[model samples]
Target: MTNNKKRQRVPHHPTSTLYSADTSRSESSLKLCRLTSNSSFNDNSTADVILRLYVDSSSPFVWDSTAEDEVQIYLHSDLLHRSKYFAALLSDRWQNPVSNINGINSDNDKKFIRLNFDVSSPTPSSISDHMTVLQLLYTDDFSSVINSVTVALDLLPVALKLLFEDCVKACVKFIEAVPWTEEEEKRVIEIIPLIREEQSRELLSRLYAPDDSCEEMLNGLIMSAIHNHPNTASVKAFVAKLLREFASRESARRVLERAFEESLKVVKESLEEYSSPDFRGDTCETEAIQRLNLHTAMTNGRHLVWLVERMIELRVADSAVKEWIEQAEFTVNLQRTFRDDAWRNIVPGLPSVVMRCTCKLANGVAGGTILATRQVRMKLVKDWLPVLIVCKDNVSPLVPSQKALYLDLEETFLRIISTLPMSDAQELLQQCLSFSTKNLEDCPHLIRAFNTWFRRATQPSLTGDHC
Candidate 1:
């Protein structure tokens, strides 16, 4: 589009006088504020609109990211038309500036930022006044203006000292608009907070897609979003939604619990740290934080499934878990694939099923063995068992009642034994019951349980098995 046909810009004008319903023009101005709050941009100006990005000085990756954000906003929102953007950032105590964002398309240092201010096209005289003012602001200030790219780097102190809200806002908005790959996303994730509540929410909304790729990298987004702007409506909704996912899948649920717990620890610590020596003194901010904490806890209760339902209930977000469950269901002729089904089908005289157990190790080497109990879970792919008894140790001596659970479980084995009459199921059970403790090996219960299960659960119609 030619500059000749482009719309005109609004000139700088500020009002010191107060406005009230008693005056017609003042009422109109109040209406504008309401409109702007909802619509973001006005037909006249984006002067009040702010985009902020919080960048870390220590991160080399943030330097370019911060500049890109600023440039995106400058390119999209006209400076002459009254839009502002900046990156708010933090630095180490010894660091000169928290972030350094100076990649301003320098053709031997011409500061291409001026090109954006020029409004791009030659146009009329009277309407050009607004553009002219901006041009002057850009040119005379060649060395004076903080380049959007440079501010995050060499000029963050000056930017903040000058309260350069516009530059900060632009950077954050650019992050919101641009798509970031996983590698790129991590670099910019931290600063979502130092911006404002509104900008942070925009960032998380973008991050919370929960795509398979997103699942792995959600920590930075969730932690920073909740930490900086927990009160934002968007953030509130997001936390609740995450809790739902946690409740759904065991893996996701576990991660969610840990994250929520960490967040709660922080909250509790802050309350303790900032507490006054009164009997729970009343105040708005504290009350708000308290209410938020309560809401999260209450939500967790409603959302977290009990241990029995946790593993058994059918919510499988992980590919591996889904595969295991599918195989488990197939034992009942439900035909769920266990492992690679084609491979397992060829096992001669065997039940064409695969059961694998996983013992998840904690972190490094020494966090091993006994610590692996919570991690050691059994996967009965072909038959996840009508019941899976996860215990402190799978073979802890069965209590009197637990012994009954074993005796009672014989019904399943007997039923199966009755069906597999041609096979040695009956003999297997007799030997299993009388099996020496020395031969129990690593799977005494499993052997005993299989014997009991075969005898108890019977569907007797197998013609070829006898062959």
Candidate 2:
């Protein structure tokens, strides 16, 4: 019973017998060993290294060129060191010798030996054939061989560099998949500066490429962001900028907010597009304002995340809606008060609104007319998005009628006299005009009211600064 317990609890470092490249024959399988000890290790007596060799069938090997396969080792680590069969190394691992072995194409200066043998065998003829391929590595009793990667990198300077992007990506994948410890975390912090900007750009540029493979590069970026120490700041900033510069405003905004809250400049800019609510043409409604309204209204009661997720879930089958979402910016702290009956008044008499522009020079993107056809669609639905936020500074309760809604709206107008955030306030006022423009016929009374007041207020004798 004690022996069984010991066996169960024993920590075993598998012994290995690595195969080496054949000097006489051209074909052979290479092997490696994770050496634990040297004194008693022998290839014939020990079976230590376990392996799951992954190989691509299509990679110049196997029957067809499309499949991949893996071989599992039901053994120990010690067996690795005794194997001597060698093949070309592709990625630190011997490329399946059965396939076209591709070790250092020219660096074969005995880092490996060459073997050119001709044999066509589809499968292992017997168990021994497979076992025979497990060659043992040659070293001066293990203790003499220096396998320290740091020492190797220093001795062979080429080993210290990271050139193949795929290498960085693979390492990053392994890093992200594993949990980081404080010590490991510190190691990453120290490593960031050693990398060059151009090299980083080469990796970052992949994010903008027009292909799905870009996702791999993006993963590398996100993983890098996990270490946000001062050195990582540059990489982090570059990544955020790449997201902003390449992806849609919506996608960029989401990534920005997710990466780091305090560093969401891209998101703020994107939201500005929606917040301005102005698109200069005479489409009757400002695309931005209507968009914010419909979206804000739809998710009015929910948190911002809920609203975003709901949009994703709804997958609203409308082109404009989709575009608005793709392009909408997320800067506002979207937590507005949407009482149950809030939509009842503003929406019933809703104007297909557009924001007017104050630009004297020709404003192209910022100019005249954006179509709010989507807002018109939203108006048909019961949901509402408020374009004008009335921080009703000590005002009477909003009455339930159009008169009350307008009276409160008039308060918004009066605030103009008080000088609000001029840019936003001006933008809001212009949007109100677009709303008025669309519903001109319905608000004739209100329009007429304004006209009458304008005529009286602007008369030559009337000189109050309020005008």
- Indicate which candidate wins on lDDT: 1
After superposition, the stretches of candidate 1 with alpha carbons farther than 4 Å from their true spots are 1-309, 315-399, 418-421, 432-467
lDDT of each: 0.33, 0.32
- The alpha-carbon lDDT assigned to residue 348 of candidate 1 equals 16
Q: Model 1, 18-90: lDDT tens per residue?
A: 1111233223223222212322222213232222222233444332221212111111123323322221222
TM-score of 2: 0.21
Residues 207-253 of candidate 2 have per-residue lDDT tens digits of: 23665445555545654643433565576557655654554445433
The lowest-lDDT stretch of 10 consecutive residues in candidate 2 is 353-362
Alpha carbon deviation, residue 166, candidate 2 (Å): 25
Clashes of each: 44, 70
